[model samples]
Target: MLRLCAASVRLRLGLGLHPSRVSWQRQLGTHGRKESREPLNSPKRAKEFIYRLQAGERSCLLQELQNFESIAIAQETVEPSPPTAAQIKYVLFHNTLPFIGFGFLDNAIMISAGTQIELSIGITLGISTMAAAALGNLVSDLAGLGLAGYVEALASRLGMQVPELTPKQVDMWQTRLSAHTGKAIGVVIGCILGMFPLFFISDDEDKKAKTDKAKPC
Candidate 1:
C-alpha cells in the first residue's frame, strides 16, 4: 500500500499535478459526473476537465522554463523587414565603384594597345582598324581576368563593405534593380573617361597628309 501511494504521487508529479489537489475521489467524480449530472452520459464535462488540466500543466511548465535564464521558448518565425533606401544606396555604391575601375582599365588598355597594334603589325598584316580593335579587346579581356582580384581588393581597401542584409532583402527586386543600375552607370562613366586617349590619336586624313609629304613630288 505504501509503494502504491508513492507510485501515485510520482505519477501526479510527472503529470505536473499537486498531490494535495489530485485524488482518486476526484478522478472517480470526474469519470461519473456526466452521467450523474446530465443523466445522458454526455462526455463534454469530462473532456473539458481533461483539456483544462492539460492547458494548466502546459502553462505551468512554460512558466517554469521562462524563469531559467538559459532556456528560451522558440517563437514563431517573423517576416523579414524590407530594406531601407540607405541600404539600397550602400549596395549601389559598392557595386558601382569596383566596376568603374574595371571599365576604366578595360577600355583604356583596349584603346591604347589597339592603337599601337594598328600602327605596328596591323599595317604589315593589312588588318583593318576594326580588326585591330578586336585584337586589342582580346588583350583587354585577358588582362581583366587577371586584374579582377586586384580591383576587388582595391575597392575593399577603399571601404567597400558587404551590406548587412537578410537573404530575403538581398533577393528583393529593389536590390537587384539598384545593383544592375549601378553597374550600368559605372561602366558608362568609366568608358567615357577611358576615351581620353582619343585626344592624342590623329585622324586618318592627318596620317595620309604626313605620308604624302614624306614621298617625293
Candidate 2:
C-alpha cells in the first residue's frame, strides 16, 4: 500500500503537478494571489514624481536608449551583402566579348598574311582562331578596366578618398575600347575572307588558245 502511494506521487511530479493531492490543491487555489502581488511600477508614471531626488527625467539617457534601439532596428532590417567577384567577371565577359570577337573576325583577313593557311581551314577553325584572338584582346582591355575598378573598391573599403581623373587620363587607359577596336578590325577582315575565296588565279593557262585564235579558227 505504501509503495503504491509513493509511485502515484512520483508520477504526479513527473507530469508537472504537485507531488501530493493536498499540495496540488493548495497551488491551484493560490494562482491568482501571485498575479496580485506584482509591484505597481509604471515608467510613464515616473515622470510625475520628478521632484523626488532620484525621479528626475534624464533626457540624455532617453536619447541614448532611442539611438541604440534605432541602430538595432537598422541593423536587423538592412541586410549586409555585395556582389561576388565571379558575378562581376561574368557580367564583363558576356556583355563585351562576343561582339568584339565577331567584329575582329570580320576584318581579320585584311591585316594578317597567312591567307593560304586560313583558306585551308574550315569555318569552325576560322571562328575558333578568331575567337581566341578576340579573347586575348578582351583580356588586356578587361585587365586595365578591372584594375582601375579594383583599386577604387579597395580604396573605398579602406575609407580613403580617391581622386577623379581627367577625361584624357581616363581615355588613355581605356583598355576595353582599345580591345573592341582590334576586334572590329579583325571581324571586318574575317567577313571579307569568308565572303570571297582565299586566292584568285587568273585564267592565263589559255595562252595557247589565245595564240590559236590569232591564227585561223
Candidate 3:
C-alpha cells in the first residue's frame, strides 16, 4: 500500500508540469530551456533601420542631381563660337518686329481715321480728334508696348535672354490675347510688320550692320 501511494505521488508531480509552460520556455529560450524571454521587437532597432533607409535614398538622389548638373555644364563648355552677326541680327529683328509693327499700325489707323472723321464732331464730343481715335487703338498699342516691357522685365528676372520678339514675344502675346479674346490680334500685327520689313531700317551703324546681316548676302 505504501509503495503504491509513493508511485501515485510521483505521477501527480510529473502531471503538474504543464505542456503549455514547456512550449513557452522552448519558444522564448536563448540557450537553456527554463525561463521565457520577452518579445525582442525593440523600438530603437526599428527606428535605426528606417533612418538608414532614408539616408541611403537621400544620398542617391543628391548624387544623381549632381551628375546631371555636371553633364549640363560639360555640354555647355564643349560648344564653341557664339552665334554669327547675321544670326544675332535676325534674332533682334525677330524680337523687336512686333513692337515696331504695332507702332506703325497704330499710326496708320489714326491717320486713316483723321482723314475720314469730321474735326468739329470730335471737338463737340469734348474729346480731341486724336484722343477719340486713340481710345479705339488702345488695345492694340497697349499689348505691343506694355507687353514688350513686361516680357523684357520677366526675362531679366528669370535670368534668361529674351529671344527675337517676333518668334518669342509675338507668339506669347498672341497666345495671351487669344486666350482673352479668341482672336489673333497679335498675329495680324506680326503679319503686317513682316510684310513691311523694309520699314524697320535704322540710320545707326550697328543697326544697319545687323539689318544687312539679317538680309540675304
Candidate 4:
C-alpha cells in the first residue's frame, strides 16, 4: 500500500500535476480500483489512466487552435466596405491629371510635326495629309512612351496622392468607372486645348500651299 501511494505520487509529479490535485487523484484511484476489483498497485492501469489524461489534454488544445485558425480565416475573407465620396474624388484626380498632360503633349507634338512634314516632304513624296498626320502620330506616340514617366512624376510633385483603400475597394466597379470617366474628361479637355497650334496656321496659307502642290514644276 505504501509503495502504491509512493508510485502514484511519483507518477503525478512526473506528469506535472499540481501537488493538491495529486492527493485528490490518488484518493480517487484508490477507491476506483477497490470498486472495480482491480489491483491497487497495477502499473499497467496507472499508465493507461495517465495516457488517457494526456490524450484528453492534447485534444482540447487542438480544438482551441482550430477555433483560433477558423476565426482568423473568417476575418480575412470578410469583404471590405465601398470607398467613400472623398476616396472616389481622390482617385479621379490622381488618374485625371497625368492623362491630361499626356493628351496635351501628344496632340501638340503631332500637330506641329505634321504641319512641318506636310510642308517639307508631303509635296515631294506626294504624301496625302492623312498619311503625314499618321506619321506625325507615330512620332507623338514614341515621344509619349518616353515622356510617360515624366508626366506621372510631375503629377506626384503637384501633390497627387493615392487614396487609402483596401484591395477589394480598389477593385470595385464604381471606383474603376470613376477613374475611367475622369481620364476621359481630362484627355478630351487637353486635346481641345492642344488645338492652339492651328491658330498659328492661316486658312489662306493652307489654300496657297495646296495650290502650289497642284501646279506642275
Best candidate, lDDT: 4
In TM-score terms, which candidate is top?
A: 4
Worst 10 residues of 4 by lDDT: 23-32
- Candidates in order: C-alpha RMSD to true structure: 29.3, 34.3, 37.5, 31.3
Q: Rank candidates, TM-score, best first.
A: 4, 1, 3, 2
What lDDT would candidate 2 get against the real structure? 0.33
lDDT of every model, 2 decimals: 0.58, 0.33, 0.36, 0.61
Q: Write the per-residue lDDT of candidate 1 for residues 1-217, one digit (tens) a residue.
A: 3333333322332222222221211222211234334321368754543454444444553453354323222211546677899998887875677667766777788898888887777766767889989888777766765665466546656756556656567668888788767766767777788788888888885477446555776
Comparing 1 with 4 on TM-score, the higher-scoring candidate is: 4
Candidate 2's residue-wise lDDT over 86-198, tens digit each?
A: 43333233323333333233333322323332233322253343554445334433333333223222323443221222222222324334433533443345345533433
lDDT of 3 by residue, 1-217 (tens): 3333322222111112112212211211211345433332577644442353334444543454475567656655453444444544444443343333333444554344442332334433545545755653443343333443343233234432323222223234343333223112333454454344334423374344444545764
Question: What's each prediction's TM-score?
Answer: 0.60, 0.17, 0.27, 0.61
User: What shift in Å separates residue 198 of candidate 2 from its native position after superposition?
Assistant: 12
Measured with C-alpha atoms, the lDDT of residue 26 in candidate 3 is 25
Question: Residue 115 of model 2: what lDDT?
Answer: 34
By TM-score, how accurate is candidate 4? 0.61
Q: Could you tell me which 10 consecutive residues in candidate 2 have the lowest summed lDDT?
A: 19-28
Ranking by lDDT: 4, 1, 3, 2
| lDDT (Cα, 0-100) at 23 in candidate 1 | 25
